[model samples]
Target: MHPTVSGSGRLMLGFQYFLHFSVMGIVLPYFNLYCFHIGLTGFEIGAVSALRSAALVLFSLVWSILADRYSARKPIYILCIFISTGIWSLYLFTVDFWMILAITLIYGIFYSPVISFLEAFTMDALGVEKTRYGSIRVWGSVSFIAVVILIGKIIDLYRIDVILVLVLLGASLQSMASFKIPEVKRSRKHQAFLFPITLFRKEVIVFLGCAFLMLASHGAYYGFFSIHLESLGYTKTFIGFTWALASLSEIGVMIRSRTLFKNYSLHTVLVFSFMMAALRWGCLIFFRSAFTILLSQCLHSITYGAFHMSSILYMDALTPDDAKTVGQAANNAVTYGLGLMTGFFMAGALYEPIGAKGLFAISGIIALLAGAIFQTMGKRIKVFPP
Candidate 1:
């Protein structure tokens, strides 16, 4: 039977997005900053970020394989949610670099698959009305904006360590909500024992390569943007506002996803997003004024919001029905996992030598390069035939 999602199922899925991203709002802006405050060097923080991404590369695939093989996506999804939450609590017990690094790896093993699994579920749940994905996915951006704005002020009022408690609480609640996720029954016809070779099609490969570079270009921003802000003498509240602003723009694009995709090809949106990322990072390289910074932040509507939705939809279009979970897992692994891993390590290694401004310059170049290569090759090679 074709998969079907009920109203309550969609509600639970939206709740999952909110809770998961709310925790992300905490970690993305503050976790590395917390490390910095506690005396971890730039390299150490980068290592932590890269290692977690590495876990995503390896483990997301493993979990997806099992889920596809056993048809137990719900059970596996719930298991990872709870286990990762439990592991994250270990952060409260130690601040030592090595110990924290170890914890990050273990936590990442469980945490890595959660988002990919969630994406697969969302895609499956959306079913025939998948174009409305933006409506459901907007919940994540909503929670993210709210948390970053709220936590920024709270951090100004209290200790940075408070982030740990808030993240734990958010995750704990997410774990509880995981129980509400309705099981999605995939068609047995999609059941397969081997990875579909179509996954290696020239178009898919080219697309993934371009996507990899696009995300890799974000390494400096995601890994060090908060630190960059603080180094510029911006307050925690200001940093929070800046991050929240990005998500706010992201929500605008996401809210318009259905219309955007209907009017433009996924290929066009991806290319535009890549070009905008280059421009956005270039702005960061030269400007430090609040107005300029905020202006550039708005480009996130294209850079991340449009790029991400396009990438997901593109991969869905390319993959075989049997390998839906695996396709999203691969997308997450290549872009967010390996791509971010490379970016984090590069940023970490260079942060001390070149600083955040220098890192932004390099990131801009990487993004431009990705755009050029994809633009030229996509058309010449007929990667996305109309």
Candidate 2:
């Protein structure tokens, strides 16, 4: 059998995460704000984001299926990155909402699967060292913090239109870095086990359901947090700082992920994250002060950092070795795709009628419900070894 990826390859993996998420750092915080600047309606913004999420679900699955079927994850991955980078360049030529939405949909077709595939590759490369994923993934957070803060300041000095350029630059670098990713070949014996029936245990279903709700609750924050801040009269720099703060807090949890998972059960971490998510959103419902908002951002340590790492590890343990790509794909599709799509649509539809405050209230309730149901149903789940 071919050996697992070595130390240099792991470093390449870290670099890949850094570059991939650098683009995310641009899009996540500022892309919608860019849309707002161009006079897109709230619903139109939501439609763009929601359709992109839909592409994540549909296209990511198709890519993963091909990856597993042909044992060609790396080639498929590289192709997607290059193609998506090319697609994203089309943004420069248009400010029309319909054109932008179409571009987002096309871009999503190639962009959606990149992360899930990277994650699956990461798990395979790490082998027994999976728990340390946070350390490597932490590089993404670092780049994210840097980009958001820098872009925020840049936007204050210039136009929001710069976001389009920055995203293209980041994505182009990611495509170049994609060539160095190490391939992990599976044994012929394992090839026969793709998408086995046993992959969908009740525990997996419950965890995924809870994960979906958790991400769904993030709809308001991801889709419109910058616009919400602007509505509150905050400057672009401050809005960027707020987003950077969340990622900064997320870094701490990720750095200590090995210790954290060793001391607490995934069940415990997941429930606590949900509880923190509820509290975080609930705070936004009543407070608008800078201090309060930054404090709320700190809770991202639990809400996203701990919860995400645990979800990845849990899914890795549950999936069979041969089916790792599809396993991660399913996880991504369910949480980021379906969950975020629903949340974005809900937030978009309701933003005009109820505003950000009302959206946060609904989000808090959704988070609480996720925690409650998971705590009750997830107790029986077996904790995988870190």
Candidate 3:
């Protein structure tokens, strides 16, 4: 493997995450719009959107297993990312529903692992000081906000097709930058067999379950918010600006998280986050005022921002010191890989009949469940300091 991430490498790894997920934010928000721009109806749009989640379910484990077995982190990230980017590139010419569906499926299988492996790569390179992970991760949010507002303005003047081209270019840049990241291998002893269930302990299982619910709560906003705005007669430019407003809040939390998480346990941060999600989404359910929409979006900081940092910290604290690599992979497998897929699939059907208000009500309840579980049972966790 190339020389491990010295201090210099950590900064580069951060930039890579920023670049990679930024591409994700740019494309994901507009994907449903693209489907509608074609002939697809609402149902088709949800299904197409969920395809990325489906892809994660199909491939996250297989890729993680490969990364662990051979200790080949960088190559796996590079290859899978390249495949996903190439598939994304084809969207410019092809708008057929079946063809689009096929591309989504391929993207799923190849795409989910990039972030998992990359995050695992980050932890391996950074070592024990887990606080910095958020500081780096926030850059992805920053890039996302920047791209969303810019693309929004662009789309208002030009055709939506510009998104396809920009997304392809961003994905390609991430793939290229990934090449410079140092390799991370499962240490020799972990190379031997170990129980996978070790990942599913009291604190961990709760955190994962909570993370799943918290993400599920996002289904309405992520999949349906643009449509909601469209219905409300907001222009594409305004919608994009609103979306960026949320990420801008998220960036603030991420920048402050190292200090916040350091003083407060990860559980403290998580409990507060889930509570905020409930309040934010609940308000969305009852209130349609623009101020409420803007207010709720700002809370993305607590709903997504703080909870994500806490989840990473919780993962580091819970995993056996020997199993750090596996721990990171398991987080992706449960939270993003499986949990996210489950949420998106359900949201596709639910959002159509229920509408945003009903959809968000359920989101509030789910976030409450997540919070209750974390607050009551999380105290019993063994690995975390009391």
lDDT for every model?
0.88, 0.90, 0.75
Give the C-alpha lDDT of model 3: 0.75
Clash number for each model: 0, 0, 1
- Residues 1-386, candidate 1, lDDT per residue (tens digit)? 24768988988888999999999999999999999999999999999999999999999988988888778788888999899989999999998999999999999899888888898898888887777788888899999999999999999999999999999999999998998887677645434454556457778788889988998899999999999989889999999999999999999888888999889977788889899999999999888899999899999889988998888888877776678788888899999999999999999999999999899999999999888888887764442325
Better of 1 and 2 by lDDT: 2
Listed per candidate, the RMSD to the true structure in angstroms reads 1.8, 1.8, 2.6
Ranking by lDDT: 2, 1, 3
Off by more than 4 A, model 1: 187-198, 380-386
lDDT of candidate 2? 0.90
Q: Give the Cα error of residue 74 in candidate 3, in Å.
A: 1.2
lDDT of 3 by residue, 1-386 (tens): 22245777877887887898678667767878767778787667777767777667557766766666666657778899889989887777798988888888888888878777777676667566667777778878988888888888989999988888888889888888877887554454543143365555566777777787777777767777787788788888888888888889988788887788768877788899989989998987766667777877898888878887777767767765455556666777676656666566666777778776777788789889889988898777764644
Provide the lDDT at 72 for model 1. 77
Q: What's the lDDT of the predicted structure labeled candidate 1?
A: 0.88
Least accurate stretch of 10 residues (summed lDDT) in model 2?
189-198
Window of ten residues with lowest summed lDDT in model 3? 186-195
